[model samples]
Target: MANSDSGASSNNYSFKVVLLGEGCVGKTSVVLRYVEDKFNERHLTTLQASFLNKKLNIAGRRINLAIWDTAGQERFHALGPIYYRMSNGAILVYDITDEDSFQKVKNWVKELKKMLGSDICLVIAGNKIDLEKQRNVPIEEAEEYAKTVGAKHFQTSAKLNKGIEEMFLDLSQRMIERAQENDLQKASELGRSSSMRRNVVVVDDEQAAETSTSKLTCCGSTT
Candidate 1:
């Protein structure tokens, strides 16, 4: 992808991004807010996974982001690794008003690092920012955690549409830059174990997408 300020030089890029957290953290709402610019107040649990294909023009590059929303129930927890397989990026979401959710997000960050390693563009989202009065996760605390984990943090409100755009855009831009720098290949080699090749998420797909726009999993293809 091109950086307007840095001089435009780019190609079509596609990335797989997964949303993760405890149930009711507004993972679904965040993705909907980005792709449809809408929010649902009534809670709906996602089963397995649901995805959206969003195309963006950033710095004159056509970037395709295949965003996945996964179920966060304890029973569904085992499916997380499957959903996150081969993901280029991940957003660890937590309800700002729920302290447990915040803790869960931290646990998830650790799990993701173990699974996807340091190559992924990790993001921390303090969702439900509209309910500032009910906030349980302090902004400073969250920002500090993000820094510790080397993740970019954002306070977002899917209902109010705050910080959602910038968060996703930043992830996309960084992903593009990583592809351009061939950083992902290095990251993948470092993270992947030869024994777990089949268990790994779609790392090859994302790497393949570095060249072919059509090779991207436009919707859901965790494995």
Candidate 2:
């Protein structure tokens, strides 16, 4: 990928992803499992929203993921835009045992689409699969909804560390492909005749932050 104002380098890419869902849906647990490879038996409530960084080398490309875990409580819902406004992707998590949480994920999907449009990649995760016996959301139903929304679906068990790694990796790959396509489009446009050329500055909240540090600064947050 060509280096641009968006903080993408020749071999390095930085992407910001946010977790959205209702409280106690294991959003924090999912992030912890992917970024730290650890899980907390006791539930931890997020205050507002915080992010953590994970570095990966896939096919000789350096990918840096800034995963933002937001507070899912109803009271903090109004602050969601602050965290996800310029994110590259999103992970909508819901507990398999909670039907209401699944519905909440739909609401989040609508909000994200309305704000960020289809440019943002999305992944829908039905978490807490360890309690499969207590599952209220059927796998087929979730998968169908994900397909309808152009999002990939996964059944994740954060406690057991199942599907978490694959979920992040899949989302990252999708983001990388999207970014590369965008870069190609920009290059093609710039190659056009000089008569159509125009100067414009592209500025974004997340882009400015990413440009400050390659792959973004590493940070840690508990759920």
Candidate 3:
């Protein structure tokens, strides 16, 4: 979700991203590690859905990410769209040790593409690379799937903080580029429409706000 409330005068580009996966795939762990730089040894459960706000300065752009962590239990599967709908990007996590979890990620990829179309950015994270000795999903297979679906694949470990930063950074940059392209297309369409009509039409300036670089901040909440 782009910041619908932001005006043309603002400089913040807000994007909503959702995390999806099976239980114990470490979706919340990944978010906590990236946003708060903290990791918990104990297992955590997300009830329905919760979101954390992360502010990032990527290539001189102030990107505000509302990273949503949703429950991965089968009971909560029905509520997936409520959290993911209108989201700009998605991180589908799967424990490398669990082959079933990887299958679940594929299901989500199909559902997201069917509902949101190809415009939504996707990242398939084979998490818990630290447990490589017990890995069940092959790295090459996962990469191939991601490539076929037009999504990026990564190996991430919240415990060791491996690949967390790089994955989010890559996703953020992708979203920014997509948003800019959308704005340009909208501007072009508006220009053509204006040329066709001689009368001046009042329009809401829905373009993205001005952007600037900023440091990441630990600001977030759970719902």
Q: Clashing residue pairs in candidate 3, if any?
A: none
lDDT of 1 by residue, 34-133 (tens): 9999888898889889999999988778888889999988899988898887888999999999999999988888898897787788899999988999
Worst 10 residues of 2 by lDDT: 1-10
TM-score of 3: 0.85
Q: Comparing candidate 2 with candidate 3, which one achieves the higher lDDT?
A: 3
Residue 103, candidate 3: alpha-carbon lDDT: 96
Sorted by TM-score, highest first, which candidate order results?
3, 2, 1
RMSD to native, candidate 3: 18.3
Residue 149 in model 3: lDDT: 98
Instruction: Name the best candidate (by TM-score).
Output: 3
The CA lDDT of each predicted structure is 0.85, 0.88, 0.89
Worst 10 residues of 3 by lDDT: 209-218
Those runs of model 2 whose alpha carbons end farther than 4 Å from true positions after fitting are: 1-9, 193-223
Which has the better TM-score: candidate 1, or candidate 2?
A: 2
CA RMSD of each candidate after superposition: 18.0, 18.3, 18.3
> Each model's TM-score?
0.77, 0.84, 0.85
